[model samples]
Every structure is written in structure tokens, then in C-alpha cells.
Target: MTYQEKKSIVSLISAILIFGSFCLYMYPQYPEGGLGSAETFRYWGSFVLILTVVSIVAHIIISIIFNIVFRMTTKEKEPKFMDELDKLIDLKANRNSFFVFIIGFLLAMSSLIIYQPSQMMFIILIASGFISDVMGSVTKLYHYRRGV
Candidate 1:
């Protein structure tokens, strides 16, 4: 695979793993009374901070390992830099990703208006951002594979 393709795949996987892990961690802790409870809100607020730190650290470690493996497997003596086409593809992918983010943001805002739970809104915002990143990477990988 090309470097860009590999990078996108890594990013996609990272996003999925991070999000899934976060969900798994929080699922059992989810309040039976939902997010409206003050105790639940406090719990989620602290958990979100912890999750953010964990996700960031995990992604960094995964990225380092992926880069090392990629370098070891590839035959290229030097890493390839992004050309105009690559740049264009990235821009297009980001544009599409931005739309996804906007939609997610709208949904989060709507949820806040309906439920009036700041904690739920925060979680939704984080989830939406993660989904947006995953979509962006997927778009980039698709473009690379399709030679767009």
C-alpha cells in the first residue's frame, strides 16, 4: 500500500479502537437514571477527562508502532512527500469530514436542547468528533485506492 493509504488505514483503526474502548469502559458505568442526575454528570465529567487522556496516549503509541512497521516493510529508501494530487485528495477528504462533524455537532446541540443534559452533550460531542475523524480517514483511503 502507498504511504497515504497506510496512514489512513492506521488512523481509521485508531479511531475505531479508541471509540469502541471508550464505549466499553463507560457502558457499565452508565447511570440507570440517565445523565440528568448530578452524580452521573459528575462521574461522566471526570471519566471524559480520563478518556481523553487515554485516547490521546493510545493513538500516539499506535501511530509510532504503525510507522515503525511500515518503514520496516517498505522498500523505499526515502519517505515520499505529498504531491499535488495527494494534497488535493486530503483537502477533499477534509471537506467531506467537516460536513460529518457539522452534522454531529447539530445532533449534539439538538440533544442538549431536548434533554437539557450537559454531560450527554459533552459525550455526544466527543463521539461525533471521533466519527468525523474516522470518516475523514476512510474518505482519504478510498480516494487513494480508487486513484482519485
Candidate 2:
């Protein structure tokens, strides 16, 4: 497969891992309220948040490394852009990311306004919104045959 195809596959896998994290988190809460005490909540919440952040940051760093490795292995200069398809491919990732972020931001604010979700939920929502923005770009790239 091409580098772009490989990159998008890895990103999709990362998104799935994140979605898995969300699932693991929700499983405990399914029976009813999440635990009894505030202290218990704090510990678990912090644990999950730290783990999620670390996982995502690690994914990004590793992805950058993978791209570098692939480039080095291929020993070819990266593709240059002078044509219409190149320009479109170059801009599509950023354009879609920005659009998703703006929309997610608006949605998050409206969600907070109407539902008044807890502080933790607000934080998670914000994090997930950003994740969704990135996923949007990755998904677009997959369809458009662009690399990260």
C-alpha cells in the first residue's frame, strides 16, 4: 500500500483505540451513578484523563516518527505540489480540520449551555471534540488519498 494509505489506517486505528477508551469508561457507569464518593470519582477520573492524554500524545509522536522512518526508507524527496490536485490535497486536511473544530466548538458550547454537564464531562467533551476534528481530517484524507 501507499504511504498515505498506511497513514490513514494507523490514524483510524488510533481513533478506534480512543473510542475504546470511551467505552471502557462508560462500562463502569452503566449500572447507575459513577461510584459513591467524590474522592473515588476524582481518582478514577484523573487516571482516565491522564491515560487518554498520554495515549493521544504518544500516538501523534509515534505517527511523526513513522512518517520520518518511511520517508527515510523510501529515500525519495516528498511529493511537491504545483498542480491543482496537489493543492487540493494540501489544503483539504487543514480545511476540514478547521471546519470540524469550529462546528464542534459551537456544539460543545451549546451543549454546556443547555445541559450544564459536569466539569469532568465538559473537559472530556472538549477533548473529544478536538479528537473528532482530527478524525475528520483523517477520514477526509482516507477518502481523498492524502497523507497526514
Instruction: Say which candidate scores most in lDDT.
Output: 1
lDDT of 2 by residue, 29-145 (tens): 533345455755665576557666866796888687777877899886444434565456547766776666666667667776777545444455556555764665476566566
Q: Which portions of model 1 show Cα errors greater than 4 Å? A: 32-34, 77-80, 115-120
Q: Quick one: RMSD of model 2?
A: 5.3
* Worst lDDT 10-window in candidate 1: 73-82
Q: Against the true structure, what is each candidate's TM-score?
A: 0.81, 0.55
Model 1 lDDT on a 0 to 1 scale: 0.82
Task: Please give the distance, in angstroms, between residue 66's alpha carbon in candidate 2 and its true position after superposition.
Answer: 4.2
Pairs that collide, model 1: none
lDDT of each residue in 98-127, candidate 1, tens digit only: 998898889889987897668767777777
Q: What is the Cα-based TM-score of model 2? A: 0.55
